[model samples]
Target: MKILLIILFFVNASTVNAKTFSVTNLANSATSEDCLDYCVDGVCFWLVCGWGCSVKTTPHINHNLPDFVVSSYNEPGENSFSEVQSLDVMKNIQGGNLTTNSKSKRANSGLKFKEASVTGNPVAYAMGQAKYLCNSKIKPYMPYYLSTLDEKMWRSGLSDMLYLSTWVPGMNEVSSNKNQTDEFLKSWGSLYPRSGFLNQKNEVKTASVIAARALEVVSDGGARIYQSSGCTSADCMKKNGKWQMISPVEENSCRAFGIESVEELKDKVDEDGQYGWTAWRNYGCCIPGPGAFIGSSITGCLN
Candidate 1:
């Protein structure tokens, strides 16, 4: 696929404050993070410079291009947040793009979820049908082409998770990819702090969204089990299990992923074994319904 990647780098010069050096590309390589060097005493030492900004090589920052929002989408972008007065009503599809249950329900679940997103047997056929003609916006990446036909199908199926979660305001529960890309922007428009991409809300949403879709797409919901990197995975396993938590022992990484209550779920266990403790809110994806527990638990943890 023609995926866009923005790159950034830093160069060394005389270290007087505000001394502007051109910071020209010293090495002739497409990979910006490779070493191009001198040394402490003009001898060659090894420097590894990539997104992590290791010493010895110049720092390189990378960003994805053809940002999703710019593409033509079925849903309308947020227009009147203040005048709408109700987020619930704002998302209503009576005249437009929602269901009555869409307000209370986290998302379409069970077999209905299949039709709620996209449909088809051939992968390319479905992706091509992604309804740019419904509203019709213009972008280079609209019909994003990839090498494998399966990849095209995967992208098509994943479009539901990516498009809906991103385009819809309710789904964008935290600082999104747009915000992430901005915070990371260099002079050439690469994000400054590479770490910003890791704990990013968009990253979590997209990753989880893609994961959810990937599960469904690859296995047609037969492979219900998914392995996630953060809170979502932890919470999924937490629900429906005996769940002997180790307790919040100053979990720094949990907080970093927007997990506000790592400490609370620590001691929390189902004495009655009926109510599974917060599997949704504690998980990576924000289940933005009236109750926070919408996305996490499944069927009351009996098993």
Candidate 2:
């Protein structure tokens, strides 16, 4: 009896202390083929007119850097990444009890609510080390946004309702489910409210929906632009940033929201109701020339 009790105690403790995502694992997730989409897009010239023009090749690099690690889970203090577990303490004090009740309600109804946290990826610098690849704008382990702290905006859903896209169909949708013949283009959920509540049925889909919303919030506001020549528009989805699945199932590929289908991701659901993703932004760089800025030409490179 004594031996059995000791074994059970160790097993339970291991389960409680287990971490699904960590710096080491996430750093290993980086793959050369998917993360580094390096290509020479165009050429820049510094024309001296009388003197011969100095031409420099400009490369349009697609770096799948782990800008942020977004975690969406049922438990308030339970984060998949071991580093940001400390942030959960604030979550518990704020509205952890409310989240507990919401979890039970989610199981009963199709409506689901998940608390999400966005933190700087610990392995961002390591992943984005290519010569001309874009530098990460966010620092490792920096807590950008915590859903529990933004109760009025994230929980109430009032601010998001004001947007016309929220009411009108096909406005700011994450993806279109209508005529998506491609399996990787299926819709997961809406992008409005930028909140925790979602009407998704699948557990994996719910976690992804929350993660997407959190990414939209942070990219649009917190870490605006990582690339030097990237778009400066309010919509981060437009040629500014992309997402790479990092946890539960890590993918070497990186793509825009609608490009990657949620249907393919259904099977990779984490049993603990935890999910993670890395935000990848585009960057355009050119080798320096000894002359002033003049003009550049494009080679039809698709960013």
Candidate 3:
């Protein structure tokens, strides 16, 4: 009986101390806080700077691609914020497209899939049908690929929010993948217009509006909103000197944005017992889009 008790104790302890994987490499961290700080650095560099600097790397910036893939297997729940399931989804779906094609593979919009069947009434058929359904569900989560560009279809201007949130040492054009970035901008034209946003030249500032809008499109209802690094709830104030948070109360990220109090934002708890506010707001993918300036959590109507 004592031996059995000892075995049970070890089993319980192991279960209690199990660690979950993070997309960011934080294995060298000294404490949980230090680990989280490292993840945040990745956020500031790869995510924040990424919007203005590169298009190819943008999809991999955060939990967007991975979490969406995971949600295909199971409905996204409260604790969905912390998980990264990209690799598993890729392995299950398409031999893990081990090269550049993974993100761009689905770029062709007209691709089609075979229908799943379970007519044989066997366990294998059931499993196949289930996998098919999951694949089907991920269809809408796919990101858009720019079709082409027309010089006739361009607009030029910048939002105050975009000006503040985009990369520093700004230039008329910048990106790691210059060819792709220029093509993307040419397809979408200039940044969506806004009043009173300007660059040093006193012209409308141009930021990564296309990519920003894409983030909104893919995340639609799946993620939380956040304040960009230099800005906060205070920056979301209206002309009349009052803050108006347009996102739903449950989805609000900070107190300044019409949430009754910070407590409301902090009240929600994920399945992991992490506060809902922290879970949503702190996740790298949940960064606010340009529309956060206009009191909305998403990039508003683009047309």
Model 1 C-alpha lDDT per residue in residues 1-303, reported as the tens digit of each score = 110111122123222121111111110111221111111211112334457533232111111111111000112222111111121122223111221133335223221111111111111112122221011111211211111223223223333343443344433232223444442331111111110011222212222222223222222221122222222322322211111111111111211112323354424221111110001111111112221221232222111
- Count clashing residue pairs in model 1: 10
Candidate lDDT scores, in order, read: 0.20, 0.60, 0.20
Residue 150 Cα positional deviation in candidate 1, in Å, after optimal superposition: 11
Residue 203 lDDT in candidate 1: 16
- On TM-score, the leading prediction is 2
The residue-level lDDT of candidate 2 at 35 comes to 56
Model with the higher TM-score, candidate 1 or 2: 2
In TM-score terms, candidate 3 sits at 0.17
Candidate 1, superposed: residue stretches over 4 Å from native: 1-61, 66-141, 145-303
Q: What TM-score should be assigned to candidate 2?
A: 0.73
lDDT of candidate 2 over 1-303, digit per residue (tens): 532333233334422233466665555554435654556677766644445555444443443455677788766677777777776655334432323232355354567777788887656654444445556566668777677666667766676666665675555566634443332235566777677787766676677668777766675543222212122334333432466676777677776555444577657766567777776555555545545757666675655
lDDT of 1 at 199: 24
Runs in model 3 deviating more than 4 A are 1-139, 143-164, 167-260, 271-303
